[model samples]
Target: MVDLELGTLPKGRGPQLSYRLDRAVLGGGRDLKVPGSNTILDVAGLGDGVLATTLTADGSGELLKLNSAGAVVRRTPRIYTLVSASDQAAAAYASDAPLVDGQMTYGATLYSERGGSVQSVELPDVRSIKVMAYANGQVYYSASVKGSEKVAKLYSWRPGSSSRLVKTVPAPLAISPDGKLASSLPATGSDAGCSTVRGVTTGDRLFQSCEQTIGGFTPDGSVAIGTPANTDGNCAISVAALNVRSGAVIRQWRGCFYRVVAEDNDNLLMVALVSGGGQAPFSKSVLVRCAISTGACERATEITAAKEVDFAR
Candidate 1:
């Protein structure tokens, strides 16, 4: 779950910027007030707890780990952008301009929640990194170079190990859990956002759709959630579940922009933007659980007057 601190302009005139943690399910949940947290960027299950990062309005960021009871167990100094997390550890990128041999370095570092040696990896000529999978001590990230648009690269590296280039997938790559199958948006001249699910190892195309954006891959790597490209223009954006093996659309949901926050073998946790009975700037958000077998959604929680929301799990 993502929490935001609502604050207005005019120098502390309205509500002050604060942060809270909440768990939303089909039935009920409670909000957890975190005293020092102002913004929550991402959260992931790390070992027996949750690992999260905060980016403040003052151009500062911090990585923190909270126990099962929502208490801060460990935290980094400052300026660390948390990237991805596995069961035993977490990875973060140094927000402070990192340089190796007087040249800028672009990569991520691994930190253990249990406290031990830190591992680091470096990639060249890429920025705006997005993590796809972090499991079994390996982290996979995708990014494009400054001027290149034809394809993007996915890199994989374990902690304290040298990085290896995985595959030059199409732009906006989404990989499966086992790192074998992937969905990528082709860089066509006009229909550039149209994506397809393909085999990363076999180079076989599984599925393709026009004007569709990849939401996420299922936990078991058998299905994927694909959303319409223009959610704002369309009255209702269709979120479709595509089977990776047979390249078929299994089920779908009609809603605004949806992000897959967490998933098990049978269900997906989605945060959706529902119309808040206002125009333009006025909007509302809600969290819901969507069943994988059937494309049914049960509203879990509604966020009241939130300006921004982000989730990681």
Candidate 2:
């Protein structure tokens, strides 16, 4: 299950975020508070709970591992960003640039809560870097040249290993839950659709879609969930769940802007902006769920007052 965490930004903007846990199911009907956590940057689910990255009053960062009831069971300090957290560990950076930027060489760190150790390693200097996905406890990150998005090099790292270059995936890459496949969308707003790259470890090309902007993958890694894209020249968007191997759409939904988030098993959790998309206090963040076996979506929960919410797998 993609454990969900909601941040209540009463001001409608950031820097002040509260939370509500257990909303994924069972109503998680209560509010939760992390002592001294002012701003939440990112989160990754660990079973029924989550690993959260928050900023302190002095501008430092830390990671808090909370239980199902939202109580901190463990805290790891000096963590500025929560990149990806899996069953055994979490990958993060020690910098404060929101994320890695060309100007920031803040380096990366691997946190093993079970092993009780942290490993830090240096990474290359890039104009902008984005973590496309995590597979086998290794993070596949996309980096660009100092000033150009022309593509620099792809890098992957696992615990106890240094950051190293790997095959460069297409821009805006999306990897399967198991990290066995990848799909790179065409240029922003382009109609060419996507290119499915099978065997991401070997850089082997697979089938391509005429026009499907894959937002992310389901837990089972069998379906590629499409991001919000225009439908039949309309201003609104359509989200489709496409079969990875055959390029067949299992289900599709049309809406203004629905975002696909992570969840447990093979189900999908989505959020839509009932009002025009914007920061909190200005827009409404609504939650919706889609069952893979039935391709049915559930009614939205309490998101009328959402300021900003974060999700991780």
Candidate 3:
């Protein structure tokens, strides 16, 4: 996975910038630059391949995949409005493909790399599809109704089963591996920086945060990586590992993180921001593997112009 390093553009100049995706071994290896369009948004390990979503200079999204050896395998020909995929399996995306009654009509499509097929799914009354998780045998997603942000809903769909509403949550959310629990990210309000975790079937609040932003959960669903709010615009001061059940801090760190990609046992794959000396344009970023037990970090790769990271586990 690649990481995003914050950069500054000249005043009044919009977001006109170029990005790239670079790959290297977790411990140490020569950086292998992935060849593609410059504006790559996310990269994830998909089975024996790597899948990526890129935002073109024309304001369109394109999905591309590379093999384990970093060779381009497949790429979508048309652009999309939204794209979401997993490293374990295929992806689900939406496009403004047609129009009805002089209104733009949208539909969701599932692209399976393993099966080499594309299937469309119905999302009635849903305005936009934010993120999707394919775990167990179901597809978990979040969406909102047209013209209404407060009606955001979490849903699940299984083969031969209709889509079922799990619960109502905020726009961005996270789901467990078994699709049994759903969590909402911090929204804008009084409890703006706190996340809420709830049971998908019962809608019971399992845990809620007060001072930390829940990044995501581990694969086994036992713990979560959270980042505490920093007053000095530096997030390296307070990173916490929280208990999934009690929302209690199990561990903490002082690494400046742009994102927590994934965790395995006691090692954390994180995109860490290197201090740019309080300069105008903060452009240095590195992919680091941290020992959760000791807070020891080893730089694995130097990513140039990284805008976002997508991890496949």
Strongest candidate by TM-score: 3
How close is every model to the real structure, measured as TM-score?
Answer: 0.71, 0.69, 0.72
For model 3, what is the error of residue 157's alpha carbon versus the real structure, in angstroms, after optimal superposition?
Answer: 2.1
Q: Model 2: C-alpha RMSD to truth? A: 7.7
> For model 2, where is the 10-residue window of minimal lDDT?
9-18
Error of 2 at 192 (Å): 7.6
lDDT of 3 by residue, 91-146 (tens): 55443333456565445443333344555566656655654566666667676656
Q: Let me know the TM-score candidate 2 reaches against the reference structure.
A: 0.69
Give the local distance difference test score of model 2. Answer: 0.55
Candidate 2, position 128, lDDT: 46
- Model 3 segments more than 4 A misplaced: 1-34, 68-73, 77-87, 96-107, 110-113, 168-172, 185-193, 229-237, 277-282, 293-296, 301-313
User: Model 1 — which ten-residue stretch has the worst lDDT?
Assistant: 8-17
